[model samples]
Target: MSNDPLLDELRAHEEQVWDALVRGDADLDASLLCQSFLGVYGDGFADKSAHVGQLAEGATVQSYALTDLRARALGSDHAMLSYRARFMRHRRNQAEDMYVTSIWQRTEGGWINIFSQDTAAGEATD
Candidate 1:
């Protein structure tokens, strides 16, 4: 087995999260989100259930493409991940993109996402 425990753990958790989002896995989504999670949406903040419920509703997240994914350790128990997600909204029949940042903390039950913020990649204005 490898020795870099921190890096190995972080990598594993990151993959778990990304896979969940891409596959629209409600169980994994709920499991990874902290009970006190604060998610900053396009314009406001939502609690843990409110955020995860969106995924659990099975509202057809047709294709979530992640790019420029990177993770950095923030002290001993926290990690920050940044990435851009390009996804299609099946309900609206539209394509959308956003820049996302998620902060995760190692908890007794494993890794849980404590904070998340997403900004829409809007069209440039001249």
Candidate 2:
């Protein structure tokens, strides 16, 4: 972890998101996102409902690890977090690598994800 508190805090929030995916906790996942949350994935764009809806069948992700996290303040209420993620989906034998960027906004409730983008890091090797 880094010495920066913002980086650490944001990393924790990011991990929560991944944990939700692994556990298929749609409620937890929904709680972390803003009503207007937008996600850009290799497949296409997704809104908050679509993002949370993926968990309908339970546990979309099997496991995940985040690394090389970086965060920058986008004013006082917002911050951007970027990192590399290696994760395996449920029923998938191979893990996939991706670089992700997420924007979070501080609200009266707490930090909520406002936007995110994921770029595939080519293919995973054995």
Candidate 3:
């Protein structure tokens, strides 16, 4: 695995987003996701505006965190972050944990999440 500080740096960015989500800070979330951000989830797909729009429209995320983080640099200007994300949404019956991979591209300002896909981790066999 690549032991680059970029991993931690991006991880911190991801945490910042989690904080923003829980707080329903759409501006913060907007700053982190790219203009063309695309999120692929179980229900459907969402674009950048639509993604943050939820928070802007009063959607609430109770809490969230990422674990087992691993990042791979895609050339010099991009990286892929893989981890297990656990989070709870407001009014939801229960929390959900999913395996997630987010693609971030480094730009003049900084890194912005450009794409993300979530895969549900089914019940443990053991």
Candidate 4:
């Protein structure tokens, strides 16, 4: 990892978002997501609050982990991140391992996640 605090902050922001999702913390989700944030799911898109609102209802991430994380600074106020994630949703008895890309924008307060896209690493067939 570079000695760049901005990159560190960006990773922290990403972790916070996942943690908030797992914990179903609406306040944390609200704090981390931007007003213009967009979460691009495979089926469709969701705005910031509405997306987090789902988490607040009953969704909980059982375990979440990020690996192979790398970050690039796009100008001064924006950063891009790529990583592999492994997570489980206990309620659905579902698990996912995927590659994720996220874009973060700096705000007056701190770094906030503005966009996210993920692709699933499907199960192997033999």
Candidate 5:
């Protein structure tokens, strides 16, 4: 845990998203996202429904770990969280790493993820 409470809180929320993916809990995943949630991934873009729809068949991720967390408040009601995620897909032998940035906003119901982007970590250019 870090000294910043906002970072900790956002980290917890981010973990919940990974947990939902592992458990194939579409409802939980949907609940965490705002109705207008937007995700930019290497494949393309995904809205809230498309994000939760990935688990329709079952869990897609076997395991995951988050590190190098950083968070910044985007005012009082919104925050941006960035981290490195190492994870393996279900039934896959290899793991993949990606850098993720997520934006969350405070709402009457609680905090809801409003936006996110994932970038694959490729071999070092240098």
Candidate 6:
């Protein structure tokens, strides 16, 4: 998380996603996503169902962490969060790092991720 007040709040909601992924808790994952949630990945975009369905398909992340988190408020009920994430896939035994941006909207139900875009952040070279 950054020094921005808005980013701090957004970071908490974003953390929920990581927690759900590492725990393989699809229900909790779904709770953080909007019904029409759209995730833009390197391959393409995934809707809320398909995104959370990865867990059901047995995709497990053994460990994960986030850093360099930054956020901007779009309006009173909306925010955009960006961060660098590192995680290992248990099935593949490979670790990956990426920069991600997720758009969240605060509704009566709470903050739900409405959209996300991930960019592969490879190893830093000297």
The local distance difference test score of each candidate is 0.76, 0.96, 0.88, 0.84, 0.96, 0.88
Q: Which pairs in model 6 have colliding backbones?
A: none
Clash pairs (backbone) in predicted model 1: none
Model 1 lDDT tens row, 36-72: 9899987688987786677765645656676777778
Give lDDT tens digits, candidate 5, residues 1-126: 889999999999999999999999999999999999999999999999999999999899999999999999999999999999999998899999999999999989889999999999987786
- How many angstroms is residue 83 displaced in model 5 relative to the true structure, after the best TM-score fit? 0.4
Stretches of candidate 3 off by over 4 Å are: 1-3
- Point out the worst 10-residue segment of candidate 6 by lDDT: 57-66
Better of 1 and 4 by TM-score: 4
Model 3, 1-126: lDDT tens digits are: 247798888898788878888888999999999988999999999999888988965648787878899998999999999999888988797989899899999999998999999999888797
Lowest summed lDDT over 10 consecutive residues: which window, candidate 1?
1-10
| Of candidates 5 and 2, the better by TM-score | 5
**How do the residues 62-105 of candidate 2 rate in per-residue lDDT, one tens digit apiece?**
99999888899999999999999999999999989999999999
* Evaluation by lDDT, superior candidate among 2 and 4: 2
Q: What's the lDDT for residue 29 in model 6?
A: 95
Determine the backbone clash count of candidate 4: 0
- After superposition, the stretches of candidate 6 with alpha carbons farther than 4 Å from their true spots are 1-3
In model 3, state the lDDT of residue 28: 92
Cα error, residue 27 of model 1, in Å, equals 2.8
- Candidate 6 residue lDDT tens string, 39-69: 9898888999988998995537878888988
Residue lDDT tens for model 4, 1-126: 568776677778888888887888888988988899998877788898777888757547888888888889998898999988999975767778998899998889988889999888778799
